[model samples]
Structure formats: structure tokens, C-alpha cells
Target: MSTMTRTPELHPAANLPTRVSLADTLSQTMTMAWRAMLKMRRNFEQFFDVTLQPLLFTAMFAVIFGGAVSGDVSSYLPILIPGLIAQTVMTACVATGVQLREDMDKGVFDRFRVLPISRIAPLAGPMVADTLRYAIAATLTFATGIAMGYRPGGGVVGLTGAIVLAVFTGWSLAWVFTWFGTVGKSAQIVQGYSLMVMFPLTFLSNAFVPASTLPDWLQTFVKLNPVSHVVSAVRSLANEGTITAEVGWSVLALAIVVAIFAPLSVRSFKRKI
Candidate 1:
């Protein structure tokens, strides 16, 4: 007599949870953030933009353009410092997308897909780790300014507020880059496109020069430029020690940016991985 052997079929879904709880999502995101920190630590060159650029640009811009733009280095500190803070932080935000595209290309994010975690965790983790970079860049920028004899009238409290706002802005803006990373064909493409978007936003604004100095048409654009509002808010916080209408506009712009790009990044990231 021959006995027929039966094999039970297994469904992969049986082993996976239908949905990740909020607590689990948070825990998993933190774990992924730790992983990103380790990667950043191994590649110390990642700190160059945040560390070296602040030192070099702050000093170089203050010396070269200082006299030409504001009459002297001392006179330019108030304008240059806050502008540099915004520029440097936005530059840091570009790296978020480039690195993400590189990771995706190297199949790192593919590995993340197998884990039973929230889809957004891997995306959010890198941004969370990037907050440190933003903080370092903002701090070094202020330090370099002070070293050049720039005294912020805002004192410690206002300085603290400015730093916090810059970090938040960088993190929020990073989502735009994150979305690009998910959709870009390659890392270089992501970087090139990100710079294209960033340059106009930074340079066309009131970052390096006064909007009043620009032509009437350009001044109109500068007033409309969101980066100009950010720079103005930062200056108010660091140089004037008072909240201005620019601060409210900046916060509103940041909220709208995050609301739009964050979900788009998550959706695209989910599809890609």
C-alpha cells in the first residue's frame, strides 16, 4: 500500500501584521535612525558641509563681500550671519536627497522592505539623523560670525530660538529632497535637480544682499521668495530679538511644505521599495 503525502501550503502574509501600530512605528523609526547615525559616523566626510562650509563661507563671505555690500566686515555681520545660516542649512537639506538616492541605488532600502515596519520609518529615520547636521551647521555658522566680531543683539534666548527655527526649517525642507530621491533615476540626477531648485531659492532671495538694492522687478520676486521670509525671520530672532510677521509667514510656509512633500515622499518611497 502506498500512502499519499500531503504538504501544507504557507502564505507569507500569515506571518506579517496587517498594520503597524503607532508605538511600533516610532520604535522602528528610532532603530533606523540609529542605523543612519552609525553610517554617518563611519563616513566622517559627511560632516564636511556642516563643519567646513560654515567656517569657510562665514569667514570668506564676511571678508570679501562684507566691505562691498555693507561697508565693512563689522557692519555686515548682522546681515551676512543670518543669511549664511539660511544658505548653509538649505545646502545641508540637499544632501538628504542625494544620500537617500545613493542608498536606494545600493539596494539598502530594498533590505528595509523585508522588515515588518512602517513604510515611512526608513524615510523618516534619515531625516531625524539629519537634524544633527542642521544643528552643527547653524551652530558653526553663528560661531564663525561671532569670531568675526559679529555680536547678535538677540542674546542667548534669541540665539537659541534662531537655531531651533533653522533646524526645523532644514528638516521640513528635506522632505522635498526626499521626494526627489524616490523619483529620480539616479543619485547624480537627484543631486543635480536638487541644486537647480535650491540655488534660485537661496540666491534670488535677500540672503546675500538687501532686497532694496535689487531692481523693482527683482525686489518683487524677493518679497515673494519664501527663503527671504526665512532669512528675515532669522535676522529678527538673532539680530533684533523680536518676533516679526516674517516669522509667522515662515512657519506657515514650512507647515505647507511639510504637509505636501512629506506624504508625497512617503507614497513614492513605498512604491519604489
Candidate 2:
């Protein structure tokens, strides 16, 4: 004889919460951003890239190549500072991917998936929090330059514009890295690939030397490099104190990057989970 049996539910559909509203989405994202900031404050060590690296690299590059590049550190400061700002901000963005991967690997984001929050918030909130990294890296680069007697002809207003632009550009690029973080197999792989992309973009551009100094073919690449445009914009604002066409080009590039990567990262994150 067969006995009738009652079985527990295969899924807890009844327990699922309703979709969150837009305001709730915004609120959750901000809360997650605050959470990320709190984690950063507690870990303090995570700030080394935004702080110590900028200071050390700024001095090291100025001392090592200043003489050869511009004939003296004082002369080089103008060229070096703006380029360093672009470079440092980009490097600091690598953390976005690394930390995202770390979270994904450790199952931290698993908890996020269960929450009745916007899917993108857990991904984007940390990115919003990463603006602090951009701010710190850029400010330290400029402060290091000023300490080394690199007085920007641009003065306060110009310096402020350049810093704002750098922060925006860095934040935009970080979206691309965030996409990488979502798709990557692990944190190390993401960072390795990110470094591979970053080093070429930073070093092959006009950041370290005048484009004309490079071979003709390489000069063409440097001229076309978006980073070159960013550096040029910063240099114009910081050194010449002018907001030129270069600034427009840089901003356009940043907008394009954000428009492309923000959606891609969100989609990739949803796929992963």
C-alpha cells in the first residue's frame, strides 16, 4: 500500500518581497555606498594606492627623469604634474575591479542578491564610493607637485577644474574595470588583465614625453590615445590656465566610456549572479 506524504515547498516564492521603487533603489545604493566607505575607513590599508603610491611615484618620477625630460625638476614639474594626475587617477581605478572581484569571490555579493534592492546598486554603490580614491589620488598628485615647487599658472579655479575632470574621467573608466570584475574568473586575473591594459595606455601615450619625441608611428598612436587628450586638457588648464578644445575632447571621451561601460557592467553583474 502507498502512503500519502506531504512535502515541503521546493521554493519559498511566498516569502519573496515585491520589487523596490526608484526612491528605494536610490536609498539602497546610497546605503551601500556608505557601507563601502565604512569598510574603507576600517581597513585603512586599502588607501595605500590613493595616498602613499602617489607621493612616492610623484617624487621618484620627478627626480629620475626630470633632468632628462625637461632639463630640470623645476622645469619638469609643469609637464609631470598633469601627466601624473592622469596616471595616478587611472591606477587608482584598478582597485574598483580588484575589490569587486574580492567581494564576488568571498560570497559577499551572494548576500546582496537575496536583498530586495536594485540589482545594480550593489555593483554601482561601491563605484560611487570609489570616488574617494579618485579624489585622494588626484589631490595628492597635485599637492606633491605643489610641494616640489610646481606652481600651476592656472591658479585655484583652473586647478579645481582639472581635479574635477580627473575625478570624473577616473570614475568613468572604473565602470569598464567593474565590468571586468564581474566577468573575470578571479581577482588576480582581473587585476593582471587590467594592468596589461593600463600600462600600455599610460606609458605608450604622451604622459611621459612629448608626442613628437616618439617615432612617427608611435606619435600617431600617442596623438590618438584618449589619455593623451586627457593629459593635454589637464596641462592646458594647469600649466597654461586655459580651457581649450582639449578639455571638450577629454570630456567627450569620458562620456562615451561611461555610456558604454555602465550598462555593460550592470548586465554582466546580473549574468554572474
Candidate 3:
């Protein structure tokens, strides 16, 4: 009689315990994000580009507007400071999409797609890194503003709130850039398209000046521009030391924008991957 070799039965229960915990997943995502940050650090030029351009833009605006528009550097410093901060943070959002497109073009994402990681984690991880970029930009802009003699009447707490608001706005806007990155054909195209879209949203609003100063037809649009509310909110916090309905409404509007765009961006990212 031939002995029958019985193969050990595979147990489903044995496999169940092998699945990764959410904590482990999050740890892995953080590792990936850290790696991405390391890569950025090694590439010093790219890092400088992201960090320096915003600083130069802020300084240029301060000089141009200080001399030409306001004619009094000290007087305009207060108003221009908030506007520069708003513009810088808003512009920083475009880098998310442009970088995403660059990574995709370089097949960095293709490697990520093959890994056994959470789908949303890759997209989410880069966004986490981008927050650092936002922080850097906001800090530099604020420091430069102070150097130009712009004093925040709201004191330390109020100034802190303004920085937090700017960072939050940048984070919310990243979702919009993520969608563009996933869908756009090339990094250059993404940059061009994103600038075209963002320029009006930023400039047409009350970022630089009061909406009342705009023409009647443009004033209506500027008043409705979400950037106007954000600028107004920042101005209120930094200049007045008070939180008004404008701040509340601006926060709500940013929340709505994130609610609408973030999921769409994730879905698009999923499809692309």
C-alpha cells in the first residue's frame, strides 16, 4: 500500500492575521513621505527653486507697490504684507500639480503603483511633504514683511492665526493641483494651465487692494472671489486682531472647496495609477 502524502491544508484564518494594520500602513506611508523628502533634499536646486521664487516675488511686489502704488513704503507695508502672503501661498499650490506631472513623466509613480501599499497613500504622502513647502513659503514671506516695517497690530496670537490660515489654504488648494497633475499630459502643460487658471482667481480678487477700488463690473466678481474672503480674513486677523464674519465665511468656503475637489482628485489619482 502506497502511503498517501497529505499536503498541509491552507487555513484562511492563518492568512487573516497577516494583513497589515492601519497603524502599520500609516507608518509605511510616513516612511514613503520621508523618503520623498530626502530625495528633495538631495536635489538642492529644485528645493531652492520652490523656496526662493516665492521670496523673490514677495520682495519684488513690496518694492514695486511700495514705490509706485502706495508712494509711502511704511504706510503700504501693512496692507501689502497680507496680500503678498496670500499670493505666495496661492501660487504655491500650483507646484503640487506640476511636480506630480513631473514625477509621472519620470515614472516615479509607476514604481509606486506596483508596490503593495494603500492606493491613497502615494498621493497623500506627497501632499504631506508639500505642506513643508507651504510652511517655508509662509515663514519667509512673513519674515520679509516684518523686515519691510510691516507690524501686525493683532500681536503674536493673531499673527500665528494668520500663518495657520495661509497654510490651511495651501493644503486645501493642493487637491485641485492633484487633479490637474493626474490629468495633464506634461509638466510644462500643467504649469501653464494651472497658472492660467490661478492668475484670475488670485489677481481679480481683493488680494492686492480693496474690491471697492476695482471697476464696478470687476468689483462684483472680486467680491465673490474666494481669494478675496481669504485675504480679508488674513487682513482681519493680522491687522485688526479680530475674527469677523469674513473670516468665518472664508474658512467655510475653503472647507467647501476641499470637500468638492479632494475626493475628485483622489479618484483621478486612482484612475491614473
Scored by TM-score, the top model is 1
TM-score of 3: 0.87
Q: How many pairs of residues collide in model 2?
A: 0
Which segments of candidate 2 are over 4 A away from where they belong?
A: 1-21
**Candidate 2, residues 1-273: lDDT per residue as tens digits?**
999899877667567767888898889889999999999999998889889988998999999999999899999989888888888888888889989999988888887766778987997788889888888888889999999999999999889888888999888999888888998999999999889888888998988888888999899899999999999999998887899999999999999999998899989998888
Residues 1-273 of candidate 3 have per-residue lDDT tens digits of: 899999998866555443467886687778767976987788765456447866687677777777655777777777777777777776778888898899888878787655566666777777777777777777777777788688889888888888888888888888888788988999988898889878998889887766777799999999898888888888899888899898899889889988988778778877887
lDDT of 3 at 265: 78
Rank all candidate structures by their lDDT, best first, as comma-separated numbers: 1, 2, 3
lDDT of 1 by residue, 102-133 (tens): 98999988877777789989999989999999
| Per-candidate alpha-carbon RMSD to the true structure | 1.8, 3.6, 3.0
Clashing pairs in 2: none
lDDT (CA) per prediction:
0.93, 0.89, 0.79
Angstrom error of the Cα, residue 160, model 3: value is 1.2
Model 1 regions more than 4 Å off: 1-13
Candidate 1's TM-score? 0.95
When sorted by TM-score, best at the front, the candidate numbers are 1, 2, 3
